[model samples]
Target chain A: MASLGSIATAPLRAEREGDKNAKSIVFLGLLWFAILFAVLALVVLLVTAFFDGRTRLDADLITQYSSTVFPERAGARAAILGSAMVIVTTAALAIPLGVAAGVYLEEFADPRRWYNKLIEVNLTNLAAVPAIVYGMLTAGVALSIGLPRRVVLAGAIALALLVLPVIIITTREAMRSVPQEIRQGSLALGATPLQTVWRQTLPSAIPGIATGSILALSRALGEAAPLLLLGGLVFVTYDPNGLMSGFTTSYRSRSSTGRHSHSWRFSRSHRQPLSCFWSCCCS
Target chain B: MECDGVDVYYGDFKAVCDVSLGFGYNEITALIGPSGCGKSTLLRSLNRMNDLIPEARVEGAVTFHGQSIYAKDVDPIEVRRRIGMVFQKPNPFPKSIYDNVAYGPRVTGMKAADMDDLVEEALTRSALWDEVKDKLKQSAYGLSGGQQQRLCIARTIAVRPEVILMDEPCSALDPIATSRIEDLMAELRDDYSIIIVTHNMQQAARVADRTAFFTALADETTGDRTGLLVEYDLTNKIFSSPADERTEKYITGRFG
Candidate 1:
C-alpha cells in the first residue's frame, strides 16, 4: 500500500511539473487574456448603454410606434412587433423543412449515390455563402414571385432561407449522434423506417436538436442584410397588422443607428438608439 | 419457422452457408458457437432483420407458417411484427417502462383500451412486474441490467409475436439473473417459439430443448472463414453424446 501510494503520487508530481512548462504557461496566459478582454468589453458596453438609455427604456418603448418627425420621443413598438412577426414566420417555415431534410439525409439517403453527395456538397457551400448574397437572391426571388414591396412576409422568407442550411446541418449532426443500436431495436419491433425515425430517433434527439435550433435562430435574428434587401422599410410608423404589412426590424434600427453614431459625434439623440440596439442584439 | 439451404453473405463474403434448420412451435432452440461463427447472423436472417443492412444479402429461403418470408411481394415489416428479437445488451428504449412495453402495440395500432392490460400481462410474464410495478412511469434506464433485459423481453412479447429471437440475452447478466432469465424462458416456451444464440454451452444445456452447434471452417488457400452448422439434436444428447468429433472436442474442453 505504501508502494502503491508512491507510484500514484510520483506520476501526479511529474504531471504537475510537466504542466508548468514555459510554452504552455504562455499559451494559457494568452487564452485567459483573450477571455478577459471579451468579458470586459461586454461589461463596459452594457454599463454605458444602461446609463445612456435608462430614461427611454420604459413601457412606452414597447407600446408606442416609431415617428421620424419627433425622433426624440419615437419608441420601438413597430420594430419590436415586426421582429416578432418575422421570427415567428421564420421558425414556422424553417423548423419542419430543416428537420425533415435532415431525417431524409441521415436515415434514408444512400451516401454512395452521386445525387446525395451533390446535395450534401451544395448544402455546405450554401452555409458558407455570405448573408448579403442570400439577401440578393431573395431580392431577385421576391421580384419574380410578384410579392408586394416592403412586406414583413418577404423579410421572414429571406431570414428563413438564410438559416435553413444551418438548421439542417445541426439537426443532421444531432440525429447522427443517436446510437445505431436504438434504431435496430426499434426496427426489430416492426416499425417502418418512417415510424422509427418519427417515434424513436426524433424523441431521443430532441435535446440536441433543440440546442442546435436555438443557435441557428440566434444567427438568423442577427442578420440585417437579408431584411434590407427583402424591402424592410426604415421609417414605418405603424405596427404591422399582418404578414404582408410594411415593417421595420430591430436589426434595421440597429444598422441605421450604427451609421448615425458615426456621423452624429455621440449626440444625446443617438444614445437611446445605441442602447436599444445593444439590448436587442444581446438579449 | 424454418431455414432451407439458407446462405448469408456480406457483399461477396459468405458468413453462414447452406444452413437448413426447422423450429417446432412452443420449443426453445439454442444456437451455440464460438465468436465470429455467424450464430447472430443466422438469428437475424430468420425474421428478415438482415434487410436493414445494405450490404447483407440472403440466398435460399426462410419460411414462417409455410410461407417464404423473403418473397418479393411480402413485407419485411409484417414478418418482424410476428417475430420479435432481444439483443445481447439489454436495450430498453430511453422511455418510461410503460411506454417501452406499449411501443410495439402502439406502432402496430392495437386498441387503446386493451393496452394497459396487455402491458401488465407482458410485464408479469417476464417476471419484472413485481420489481417495477410501482415505477411503471419511470425511465427504463433506471432499472438494473437484469431488470432492463427482462423489460426488453416484456416489450418483445407485447407485440403478440409467435417467435422471439434472443442473441446472448443473459451474457451481460449475473448468475442469479441468468437463472431467472432461464426460468422465464422455460415458462415462455409453453407460449412462444424461442431461438437463442449463446457462447455459453452451459446456458444452452440449462434452458434449451434443442441445440444446434455451429463451427467455423477455414480455407487455407484464401484464408477465408465461413460458419457451418455441424450437428443439432436434443440438448441431453448434444451434451452427453455428441456425434461429431468437433462437437465432442468442444463440449469436453479439448478445443473451441
Candidate 2:
C-alpha cells in the first residue's frame, strides 16, 4: 500500500512544484518592484535638490548674512548658528531629564500604582501630540511669564518639550533591552538600585540612548511650525550671541519670493547635514 | 544567616510557605528540589534579595548575625554586603577580567591601594588565576563558561561577605566544570557559610554538610502550587536514611 501511494503521488508532487514556482516568482517580482519604487523616489528627491541649488552651494552661502536686495549674495549664517544653538540647548535639556525619567519608570516605579500608570499613559499620548501644540505651549508660557518673545531660549525650550517624550520612550526601550539577569547579578552583590542603574544599566544603555537622542534632536531641528508659533519666523541679519538673544532657525527662515528663495536654499543646506547625521545614527 | 517560618509572597500569590532553615559559620547547606519548588525564592530571602521585586514580600524573620535583616532600621544594602550571591548563569560584566574581579570591592568603597591586592587575591582564591593571570586586562567575555562562573565567584568573594548564596551554580556547567565548582565550594566552606540550591541530588550528597528538601504542594481547589520544606537533616543521614517518605521517594527518583 505504501509503494502504491508513493507511485500515485509522484506526478502530483511535480505539478505542485510548478505551481509553487509560479507563486514564488510573482512574489519575487513584486518585491523587486517595491524596492525599486522606494529607491527611485529617494534618488529623484536628491537629484532635484542637487540640480536646482547646485550653484548656491558656496562659502558665501554659509558665511555671509542674508541680503534683502542682493538675493545672489544671501547666506544662512544667522539661521545656521541659531539652529545649532537651539539644538544643542535642546539636547542638553532633554537627554539627562529624559533618561532619568526613563530609568525611574522602567526600574523604580511600580506599574500597578495608579499614579505611575497615569504617567505612563500620559507620556504615550504626549508623544503623539503635534509639534505645533508644543510651540503654542512655549508661546503661552513666554507671554504669561513676561519673558522676551522669540529668543533662542524660548525656541530651544519648545523644541526640548517636543522631543522629550521621544528620548524618554527610546531610553525606556533601551533599558528594557538589558537582561533582568544583569540587574539581578548587580543587586545580589549588595549594590543599591541607584548604584545598579548607574554602574550596570546605564552604561549598557548608552548606545541606544545616544541613537534615540540624536534622532529626536534631528526631528527638533526640522520643526518650523513650533518656532513660527514662538514668533521666531521673522528674519535676523545677525547670528544669536547667546540663549536669550533673538534668533531665527533655518526652518523659520525658509519662505517664498526672491531673497527668501535664496535663503530657503540655504535652509535646505542646513537640513542636509542634520539628516545625514541622523542616518548615520540609525545605521 | 537563618530564616524562621518564612513565607514568601509574589503579590497576592504565596510562592514558598513556612520555610525554616539555618546556615552555620564555615559550613555548606544545600536546598534541593524539583522545578518551580520555590527553592530559589527561599534562598533569595536569606539575603533579602527578594526586596528587589516591588511586590515580593516575606513574612517572618530572616536574621544575619543575630540581627533581623528585615527590621525597620536595617538596610538591605548592608544585608547584601554581608551575604553575597552567585547566580545560576555566570554574569560577568562586559569588562576586563581584572575589572570584573575588582567591581565588588570598588563598589563597597575599598581603598585604591588595597583594590589591586583584593582583586588578585579573589582571582587566586576562585582558582581562575593561573588560567587568566596573563589576560587580566582582556574582556571577561573572552573566558570559557566555567572560567566565567569562577570569575563570578571571585567577584562575589571580593566583597568579603560572611555568607554566599549560590542558586544552581553548576546547572549551566559541564561535568568537569561542575566538579571544579563542587571542589571550590568545599574549599570556600572553610571561610564563609554557603547556601546552595541544587536539583542534582548527587551534588548535594557530595558537597553539602546539611541538606533540605523542598516539595511543591498543589492545592486541589485553587490549583495553585506552593513550595514547602519536607525534611532537613545532616547530608549523610538524609541520603543514607531519610526520615520522611516523600524525601526518600524524591531521593530514589521514584517521583518529584
Best by lDDT: 2
| Candidate with maximal DockQ | 1
The regions of model 1 sitting more than 4 angstroms off are A1-18, A21-24, A251-283, B111-113, B219-224
Query: What lDDT, from 0 to 1, does candidate 2 have?
Result: 0.87
Q: How do all models score by TM-score?
A: 0.90, 0.91
**How close is each model in CA RMSD to the real structure?**
3.8, 5.0
Q: How much lDDT does each candidate structure score?
A: 0.85, 0.87
lDDT of 2 by residue, B1-256 (tens): 7789999999988999998877778999999988888999998888888887878999988888889999999988878888999999999998899988887777777665777788889988999899998999999999989999999999999899999999999999999999999999999998999999999999999999999999999989988889999999999999999999999999999975
lDDT of 2 by residue, A1-283 (tens): 5776567444533444653687799998999999999998678657756775788778987897776666566788888899899899998899899999999999998898999999999999999999999999999988998997689889989999999999999999999999888888788777888888999999999999999999999999988889888988467899799989989886223334434332353235434664344334432
